[model samples]
Target: MRIPLIAGNWKMNGSLALIEDFGNAFSRTSFLSNAIDIAVIPPFLYLANADEAFEGTPVQIGAQTLYGEASGAFTGAVSASMLKEFGVHYVLVGHSERRTLFKEDDAAILAQARAAIDEGIVPILCVGETLEERDENRFDDVVLGQLDAVMKGLSEEQRRQLVVAYEPVWAIGTGRTATPEQAQEVHASLRARLRHYDENLADNMRLLYGGSMKPANAQELLSQADIDGGLIGGASLKPDDFIAICHAAG
Candidate 1:
């Protein structure tokens, strides 16, 4: 059975104080010691702070994003190696905001994924469709296309280390969530696509559902066969809600 992974993406939110407080509080919670994988993806500037706070706890630390190149004149861009120095265990790639707002194409995302994997960081590759795409009935195509570039070139070992989060664009941060059935359909499709590459990976790979996955709906959503976990947003900032979601996964 795949272990459930609930990763909190703090996004551009959080100061050093918030990171430290959250980590200290979360670390004290015994639920983390249960049969589940938990990670906190804080902003670039606070990775080390969060790491220190989460030290001696089961919560792993990660980064919101990273530059694809190892070293460059790209001012303000952070490399995977730098993140590794901060002990980042995972990296978010192709988040909808990065894709739509910053216009990061699939090629760049693929490069980022490769860089993170090379540095022994698990890349939480985000794939999703906008409301229009889903309405047009092209949701699957859009999502699977996002995966093709990054996934196609990965070695089997690299593939196994990845975590895929399906966050429908419309639902993200909009207080809307895909019904369990809707999320499961896409997760099943993603798993089926992976089977073409490696059966074991398809079976064992963890697929998380993103977009407004809160305490109230967590249990039902997680009950689906292919929905392995969640990539949380707003609710993650609150200790009770985030811990509740983790408990639901358990």
Candidate 2:
């Protein structure tokens, strides 16, 4: 069985104060232990601070994004190597905002994931269909296409190292969530496709539900067989709520 991983994606948000606050949460609570894996994706500036703050705990520090190449003259771009230097263990690849606002394509996103994977960092690949695509009845096709674009290029070991987050574009941060059944349907399909690669790896792989997952709906969603955990957004900015969601995973 896959061990649940409840990660907080701070997006473009973080602060020294928040790191300190998180440190307190980890130290004071036994719930943040080995029962489940925990991680916080802070902004670029606070990566070191977050890593340092959570150094002695089970909670890991992750990056929201990264440049695919190891080194380049690409100004303002952070490479996976730089992230590794700061102790980043996981990264969010192809987040909706990066795909929509920044126009990052599937190939580029997978390159970033490959860079991180090459550096021994785990990549939580974000794959989902938009509202329009789902409305047009292309949900499964679109999601699998995005997933295939990345998976086909990876080795079996690299594929196993990946974590998938199925964030239906329609539900993300709109104060709406896919019902447990709705979310499970997508997760199940994703896993079924994964099974074609290697049944054992697919069964052990974690497929997270990333769209608008919060404390109120966490329990029911987590109970789904294929929905391993969450790639939390808005709720992640709130320590109590994020932790509550993690606790619910248990």
Candidate 3:
């Protein structure tokens, strides 16, 4: 069975002290079970701090974003290799914020995903539809389009190292969430799409739901057959809530 992964996306939040505190708090909690794996995706600036803080613990540190290029004259851009130095295990690629705010196109996202895979980092590729697209009945088309774009040049081995996160744009940080049934349908469809490339890989891939997934609703969502885990947002900042979601996953 695919190991349930509860990854906390710190986004643009957190300070060194906060991360250290969280690391200490998380270590003290009884949430580190063999049934699941946990990761903390902090901002790039604090990756080293988190890495040191969470050392010797089950919690792994990840990067919120990374540039596609390995080494270039591109100022203010971080490469996958740079993240690897900090012992980063996972990288968020094509996140909704990257796609919507920074205008990262499909090809750019694909390049970033490839860079992460090439550097031996697991990329949590985010794919989902917007409220407008869903209302217009183009949900599957939009989501599948994003997935296909990333799969274009990736080898089967690289594909196996990926973790797809289905985070509907409308529900993200908007206080709205996809019902268990709604989320399951999209997850099931995405898994089916993966089968076209490699049936074994598709069956083993871990698909996570991200969109205001909190302690209150985590159990029901985790109970879904297709929904393996979560790419948490706000709730993740709180140690209790994050651990609660992990418990739910277990």
Kindly list the per-residue Cα lDDT of model 1 for residues 1-250, writing each as its tens digit: 8999999998888887787778777767886456899998888888888889888878899898898999979999999999999999999999999999999999999899999999999999999999888879997579998887778978888888899999889775566667899889999999999998989989999999997899999999999999999999998888788889998997
Note the clash tally of each candidate: 0, 0, 0
What ranges in model 2 sit over 4 Å off? Answer: 173-176
Which pairs clash in model 3? none
lDDT of 2 by residue, 1-250 (tens): 6889999998877778988998888767666355799989999999888888887778898999999888969999999989999999999998888998999998899899899999999999898887778779997678998888889989998998899998889776466557899999999999999887888978899999987888999999999989999999899988789888988997
**Model 2 clash pairs?**
none
Flag regions of model 1 displaced more than 4 Å. Answer: 32-34, 173-176
TM-score of each: 0.96, 0.96, 0.96
Write out the backbone clash pairs for model 1. Answer: none
lDDT of 3 at 144: 93
* Model 3 TM-score (2 dp): 0.96
| Global lDDT of model 1 | 0.89
**All candidates' lDDT scores?**
0.89, 0.88, 0.89
